[model samples]
Target: MASNIPKFRFLTAAQVRRLHGTLIANAQPTQPALLESAVQSPLNIKYYNNEQNLFQLAASLPEKIMKNHAYQDGNKRTALVAADMFLKINGYKLQETPLQTGNVSQDLENAHVAVCTNAWTAEELGRFYEQSAKAIEEWTPEILAYRNEATEY
Candidate 1:
């Protein structure tokens, strides 16, 4: 079945640079190769022309960004933020409680280590995204407003 989620607009290299600059303190500048990979990862997914679902797309994005080492530092942080933004744009969100946030952090660290050690497959990372995120049935007015505002810029 087709996913209910909307198609995603991948972050541009300029946008990634802006996000990194804004989010990281004294951040190391992004390399051209890293920026290209960051933009390409989602574009590849967007045109995969396969039967992949939205959760799979959401999950793969962070994994691709993180594993590709898209920044001199803060790859994990960037991956998480990019994935979250992708999900939000597609009408989903990661529903994390305080406890879940801790778990997610630990999971992210483990995933990083696994990727570094060549012990994790992209499929595994995609599964993690699917497990952590859920489709939103009803958005609160506040959340809707926030999403609207976020997309406006």
Candidate 2:
């Protein structure tokens, strides 16, 4: 039997950043394209409709849209930005991503796909749009602190 769970791979902050930037750039043509391509694209719209599906797809590191770096210094930001745009285009409202400061850990072995070391997993990125979602609601402030502490290492 094959497992449906995507394998989790630890990534450097740079790698994650690159991934984020790529996704946003790839889907740049449409305003809120996540809705159109993800919802009305000629292929696989149903899967994009559910939260789990979005998580599975986002967690899958090998996805083309998830790995195409189109900008400097903001891959993860870009990915979330693109995801937000996609969702909005498809009729979903999302909150803006918080400010990011460089300071991720050099220890990539334990890294998870979160907005930052203290945020939720990249798979949970949709929570930003979910009603009453609190995972990353105030995480930017903590992340800023984390960045400060990280610089000393």
On TM-score, the leading prediction is 1
User: What are the lDDT figures for the candidates, one per model?
Assistant: 0.61, 0.34
Pull out the clashing pairs in model 1: none
**Residue 93, candidate 2: how far off, in angstroms?**
1.4
* RMSD for each of the candidates: 4.8, 14.8
**Per-residue lDDT over 6-105 for candidate 1, one digit per residue giving the tens place of the 0 to 100 score:** 5444555555555566655457545668666765665676576453466666666667667677678877766666666566656766644211356666
Residue 98: error of model 2 in Å?
A: 8.9
Task: Put down candidate 2 lDDT per residue, 37-61, tens digits, no spaces.
Answer: 3222212322344333433333333
10 residues in a row with least lDDT, candidate 2: 103-112
- Model 1 poorest 10 in a row by lDDT: 144-153
In TM-score terms, candidate 1 sits at: 0.68
